[model samples]
Target: MHASATRLPSAAAWTVGDITVRRIDEIALPPQTGPWLLPGATPEVVSQLPWLKPDFADETNVLRLASHSFALTVDGMRVLIDTGIGNAKTRANPAWHDLDTDYLTRLAAIGFTPESVDLVLLTHLHTDHVGWNTRAEGGSWVPTFPNARYLTTRTEWDFWSTTELDEPRTQMFRDSIHPIRDAGLLDVVDVSAEGTTVAPGLTLLPTPGHTPGQVAVRIDSRGATALVTGDCVHHPVQLADDALGSCVDIDPEQATATRRALLASLAGTDTLVLGSHFPAPTAGHVVTDGDAYRFLPYGM
Candidate 1:
């Protein structure tokens, strides 16, 4: 862990009736992350959307992106959505490799310790998202959340497990993912087009395209609803234009479709939109911006 890591995030949050969703602090991804992840969101494109400046992007038009997770408690069940890039692991991406952030310390500070987590909802099995699934222990990787059931879509599990992985992905699985499965902690759920309810107020909405089985987490409690945009929507720039997609997307066309539909559902609704990769002021409401949409963050 870094010695100077902040004790807490800015503490961004939204309430879904009874559950208080907290944005657990993780490393603020470097500026280079924006270009590589969302190649279509050029400086020209982001400049046109004045709303994105300062918070979502820098003056130079570099989009701001972060790696964080949402945590909450309901009915005595603790739920953590998406684990960020972990520490001391071999990663192909230089920004992610050997990241030694105090992510777990921040999580534990919020009362969601490795042992306290009941459900670890993985949006997808990407390297950054699943890094925390395991930790270097006795020269071998082990499940970080030993007590929690690591839940993911059956489609996602099957695709990765069966497909021939490249060296990087193979290394990722060997270190961060396989340990969970070996520990009998990995559980897959079949999500239909309509979506699947995972817990009392939590539902996994199928938003494929970024990956074969990527699902966005929807939390509804006491009539209030909030949606967590997993990989389906990487950054707020995608909100300005549906065409702006991540270069790593498995299917660009389908990813665009999923993003469009998901944004439409959220447009002008009370449902709080929590972006998995969004920078501070991460949770917000979606608003239409003439032929497109803009993220009206919570504070403003």
Candidate 2:
């Protein structure tokens, strides 16, 4: 069991039929992170989208982003999606290197204790998404959720395992990914053209391009549907124009195509679009706006 040293307040959860998905708030990304991550979302572009102001962006129209995990229970199984930048981990990115947050406490608030989690889903093996896979333990890194199966796509693991990683990425793997694998907790699943259903009403939809194996998690129940967009759609601004690409996108053109297609599929539908990085009121419905689409905040 992961020890809860302290407690912190967490955000609200939205219901998708019987399941209640809560956002375990980590640190809100600094203002600079927005511009750096999605440089194309300039003041002029973001401001033009009137719906993005006051909540999704600042007065200057700088995007608002966050690092968080989505926790929910399905069939008595506790599932956590995309662990955030963990506590006290070394990283080349100053924003992510060796920090502290109340992420664990937030998860526990939603009944997601480390030992109790059955599945830790990784949309891709990105540093931020996988940082919490391991925790500092007696001068060494160990699996944070020792009992849970840390899962990702087979393609993702294959790509990273064979690719030559730079020092920074290698350091992340050494501390985060490697420890989980070494402890025999990592599980790689094959995401097919039709998508893979991990559990009842929970399917992993292939949304490649952010990375070759990125996935968007879909939840369906009681005739309702919700999609947890991993990095496929980083923010609401992207909905306004698919051309606004993230700087970190592995394959820019493919990423844009995936985002565009996903948005098109969700527009004018009832599917609840849950953005993995959207700052607040992250759950919403995608609706068509002019030539592109726009995100209509949930219950709004």
Candidate 3:
């Protein structure tokens, strides 16, 4: 952990009917300038979205972005949505390189340990999303959740395993992903199906373009619904302006289209939207705001 790490409150949980979704934070970042993070998120543009103030943005209008994971508990199983950057891993970005945090400790506090996790789902095989899939053990990487089965789309697995990646990213695969497969615990599913059901009320919806096989988890129970957005819409600002795209998107045009379509489908509906990188109070509902859309965060 960083010496100046900020201590956030205990993980918060929200219920969609009988299922409970909990947030376990790895890091809550300080304000980051709009232009630096999202080119289209200029000061002038972000300033106009007054709804961003306080929670999503600060007084100066800098956007707040965090890296965390969600725990979905139902049907007598513990499902981890995405694993944030793990401890002692080699990363290209200095900020993410070789470090430590009490991610598992926090999970334990919320009544889960590595072994207790029944399933580990990765929206995509990005460095940040798959970091905790494995951990350093006696100078070798090993699956962190010994008993859990890690799930990834067949398309995603094929793409990453065969495509040439940079040294750092390749290292990410070596340390976090391959070990799980080596342990005979990784399962590649067909995401092209109408919906891939992980449990009774939980399903995976393909929302490619952030990565070729990226997916979003949809939960429906007792008529209550929620969508776990996996970088499809990184920030609430994207909801207000569909033209803006993430600087790191693999296919910007496809990503933008996916975001617009996803937002359009859920706008004005009651489906809860939980963003993978959204700041605190990350659960919300997407509502139509004029020709564009806006994120109506929970409790606001």
lDDT of each: 0.88, 0.87, 0.85
Whichever of 2 and 3 has more TM-score, that candidate is 2
Which prediction has the highest lDDT against the true structure? Answer: 1
Cα lDDT tens digits for candidate 3, 76-131: 88999989888998887665788688898989988889999999989999988999
Q: Residue-wise lDDT of candidate 1 within 1-300, one digit each (tens)?
A: 000111244456666787888888788999999989998888998888889978899999999999998898978999999998889989889998888888898888777889999999999999889989998889899999999999999999999989999999999999988899999999999998999998999999999999999999999888788889999998888888988889989999999999999999989888888899999878778899999999988756
User: In model 3, how large is the Cα lDDT of residue 239?
Assistant: 92
Listed in order, each prediction's TM-score against the native is: 0.96, 0.96, 0.94
Q: Which stretches of candidate 3 lie over 4 Å from their true place?
A: 1-9, 30-36
User: What TM value does model 1 have?
Assistant: 0.96
- For candidate 1, give the lDDT: 0.88
234: Cα error in model 2, Å:
0.7
lDDT of 2 by residue, 147-263 (tens): 898889998999999999999999989999988898899999999988999988899999989999999999988888888999999999998998789999999999999998889
Name the candidate, 1 or 2, with the larger lDDT value. 1
What's the distance in Å from true for residue 55, model 3?
0.8
Worst 10 residues of 1 by lDDT: 1-10
